[model samples]
Target: MKNVLIVDDERSFLSSVSEGLSAYAAEFNTLTAENGKKAIEILNSTQVDLVVTDLKMPEMDGFELLAYMSRQFPDIPVIVMTAYGTPEIKERVQSMRVSQYLEKPLDFKELVDKIFLELAASSEGYIRGITLPTFLQLVEMERKTCTLKITSKGRIGYLYFNEGQLIGAETETDKGEKAAYEIVCWEDAEIEIESICRRKHRNISTTLGHIIMEGFRLKDEKERAVEKENIIEVGIEETGEVDGEEEIILETLEKEEKMNTLKDILNEFTKLQSVTAVCLVGRDGFLLDSIARTGIDTEMVGAIASSGFGAAESMGRQLGKGELTMSMLEFENGPVMFSPVGENAFLVIVAEKDANLGMIRLKLKKHSHELAAVAAI
Candidate 1:
């Protein structure tokens, strides 16, 4: 049901591994490549669920391939195999977040078990190293009838899809459309799939694409509400002292308590009537923290902002400009501003077109130092 790509330069080893893993034909449709270059070609053309690759190859070895995957096909998990795996090599490979690493002369049975574990660990299926949308899209493409159990940030929920149609969903307290939207919007959620769909009635009639889009819309609203609460909590607790760390017992409160205080500054900016959204995006295109009104897609905005900023920064360097200080874009509707928050994060502000840019820039300049402290922590 899943496509797995195997890459090895040695013709004999490649043939043997492919032939041996043929037993899993019921679970995976296997594909093979002689080197990383070919493997990338196959990846570009095929929908691969996983990649099992040998480290040393004639051209574009596994390390290079792995690096390429990290940038382009990050959703696909990889299993790295190599005979010359030393501690140094293992450490470097692990940094890339490969699913598994195996030294040469692999145990065939153990390898099979590992593959199955990576695919789906138990009688109940499992999914990791992939986004929820991608996984749901796969389910729809395959016309799967299954119950997807999800756990995220201590909340648990279930989504029931019968023959690729989402029929029902539930959380501990909510059910139907609301629950479905919430479940689908979860990021980095751990998922388990059961092949049976128990719900007989359909609560959702919208197409899957529409549902996903709406789910994201709802997610952004929920995040803003949470941010509002955090803001209120910290605003009232803000002391006249510029330094709050003196009151925080480092040994007792832990780093998390100290680190969260950084966002407290952003909460103050939202008090401005013109500012509609505030987001902190990491360099890797992840939405770290945000506060925005309904109808805003913070996730999409963050990803786009990260990509756009990265490109702009690269362009500046190519033009022989010094490091970029700030990037701003204005439309007829409103103006958006971006500035480096810290080493690895960027601060984004979405404001009304009529908003005072000078005032906002001044506030950002004054508070940017505070933000940097939070980012450092």
Candidate 2:
């Protein structure tokens, strides 16, 4: 659940706001403060997720509190409020990391929406604003599972969390796991988790073995294209040519004809028994496309490979030398080979952990030039 701390200098304002929040049904643990001093003490002692404070106060102004929060606990979302929304105050509040600023005679709906957005974001292990859903999806793709337990009114509930979203409940309720799943998915359930225990017992979307078989099947299909002749060829293929765009087009046809057999040529490398997936991605890492056994996001895998290879390039540049020749990444159950085909492309092959690296490296070396030319297309 998102925790909200509201601070105002006016005693009546504090009481009314707190009482109003109480009167209205909501899913938040709301706290109130009449002064900044009490707010600070509470902030230091408690895990206050979001803060709403008045611009002008006795001890510390909203801006002062903003500055303090920014310096110390920058992750906490702050929203500055004031009756007089002068240009100066607006600009000042905006300058800080305040999530939202509100004028007097607050629009409760807007405030509620902003609060909901802020709290939703904060619940995803984010203090301040950061890209979400994408990160959350990435975690889901990884198939992570845990227990999210929250406490309220002295009663704590344990909800089962899968990947990054709450999937169900560890503790049986009146309705059971089905209700927990529905509640977490549809309702804005604040998993005010008092504790978390990561127990990876749940099944993932795809298994490693399944991914490998699909990769091998892709390689087999590529092999059938072998008997074709090079009716054309493309480029300044890999190396740049002095000729301009017109010639590049002519070269493209040539490349197409040559590569009519390119996939087949890649196939000649002998698809390993351990191959889970064989994907062809551009040098920049955009997946030209892929072949996977299971429901894996081939696009994401392509992106990850591209990103890793990009980082590798950066590492090479930092040394002022040493071009990235070949690279390999090993997981517990499998490994990925980053075989550079040319100046701007690579051949990625996923193999089982137990697969022979020597054979894979040899095949990559043999097909390095051919893969580069194909990728350039």
C-alpha RMSD of each candidate structure in angstroms: 18.2, 21.3
Worst 10 residues of 2 by lDDT: 129-138
lDDT of 1 at 119: 70
The most accurate candidate by TM-score is: 1
lDDT of 1 by residue, 1-377 (tens): 78889899888887898899898788888899999899999999998888888766777666456545644676677676755336643443332223455667888886786677667632233333445654565455446687877777899998888988888889998988888888888765666666689788988777665666678656655665676567545644664332465345333233454455555557756755367888888888788788887888989889999988998899999999978889999989898999888788888889886454654665576567657766665
Give the RMSD in angstroms, all C-alphas superposed, for model 2. Answer: 21.3
In order, what lDDT does every prediction score? 0.71, 0.57
TM-score for each predicted model, relative to the true structure: 0.36, 0.33
Model 1 segments beyond 4 Å from truth?
84-97, 121-377
